[model samples]
Target: MRRDELLDAAEGLLCDQGSAALTLAAVADRAGVSKGGLLYHYGSKEALIKGMVERLIEDFDELVAAQPGETYTERYVGATMAAVRSGRLRRWAVVTSASGNLFLLAPLREAMTRWHREGLSEEPDPLASQIARLACEGLWDVASHDPGLNSEDDLQALEARLRALLASTA
Candidate 1:
């Protein structure tokens, strides 16, 4: 299969079964590709996961880059809300939890750190960003693990509140 097709299969596997079921062989089967083909694209499971993380980071960066003249706070809040709306971030969070893989945290942390640093003229205080990030993450965590909290209206309200909070920081 094609490279994009392989990654798409991997992402679907990750979303449906979490990271525990994301074996290269399984991904290959899901993508209808040979094991060797999967290996050719991603030499190992670690590499595959790393690539996913990288893709997520790149996606976020592209979102940020797309808004040329927006304030840092606006870009940050917009990118985060967009992620929530898309649901990929929530799926990635679940996959990370299922895998117990610390490596996946690095890129996210780096992105947040850079945003915190460049987003302000002061001493790079990330408290506001962290609070917003954690709030969204909390929403995702609750929604993923608790069926009772799965309300789209509630999520939209939470996203609005997050945007308000992020805006207040600017």
Candidate 2:
């Protein structure tokens, strides 16, 4: 739990305070622990970022699993919307992109690459799967920069339309 708290502090520093402020000392300060204590758990910024990425992956998977769906395609679509709406995806995008650390960035890419190959669909409707996945990815991009660009009503309307389209094809 202490490790998680420190990581949460680091994530806050990255998402709210900007990646530039996400230092070992800053995380220690934010977490209210000694710098040495932070070091004892994380060893360095790279390790912290790695942990964040791992935790992010786990959170995403868990959330996706909780959504109602019988197949990967349906759950993935629902998970994408849930992730975007929850601001989890946005926070992750900002932290990783702005972190400017390749070592921290590399594993995220690698993990996603593996998940993509394994988790996504190669189904009867390849085009539908691709379009749905791509649209969700675009939404993640939009939500990351300026979430206020779309209101709650607008997002719900859009989600309804997308789900309807998916249902029609089913």
Number of the predicted model whose lDDT against the real structure is largest: 2
34-66: candidate 2 lDDT, tens digit per residue = 999999999988888888888888887787688
Displacement of residue 13 (Cα, Å) in model 1 is: 1.3
- Which portions of model 2 show Cα errors greater than 4 Å? 119-122
RMSD of each: 3.6, 1.9
Which runs in model 1 stand beyond 4 Å of their true positions? Answer: 67-69, 122-170
Worst 10 residues of 1 by lDDT: 116-125
| Superposition TM-score, candidate 2 onto the true structure | 0.89
What tens-digit string does per-residue lDDT give for candidate 1 at 67-107?
Answer: 53345655665666566566656556654554457875677
TM-score of each: 0.73, 0.89
TM-score of 1: 0.73
- Superposing every Cα of model 1 onto the true structure, what RMSD results? 3.6
The local lDDT score (0 to 100) that residue 167 gets in candidate 2 is 69
Evaluated at residue 100, the lDDT of candidate 2 is: 70
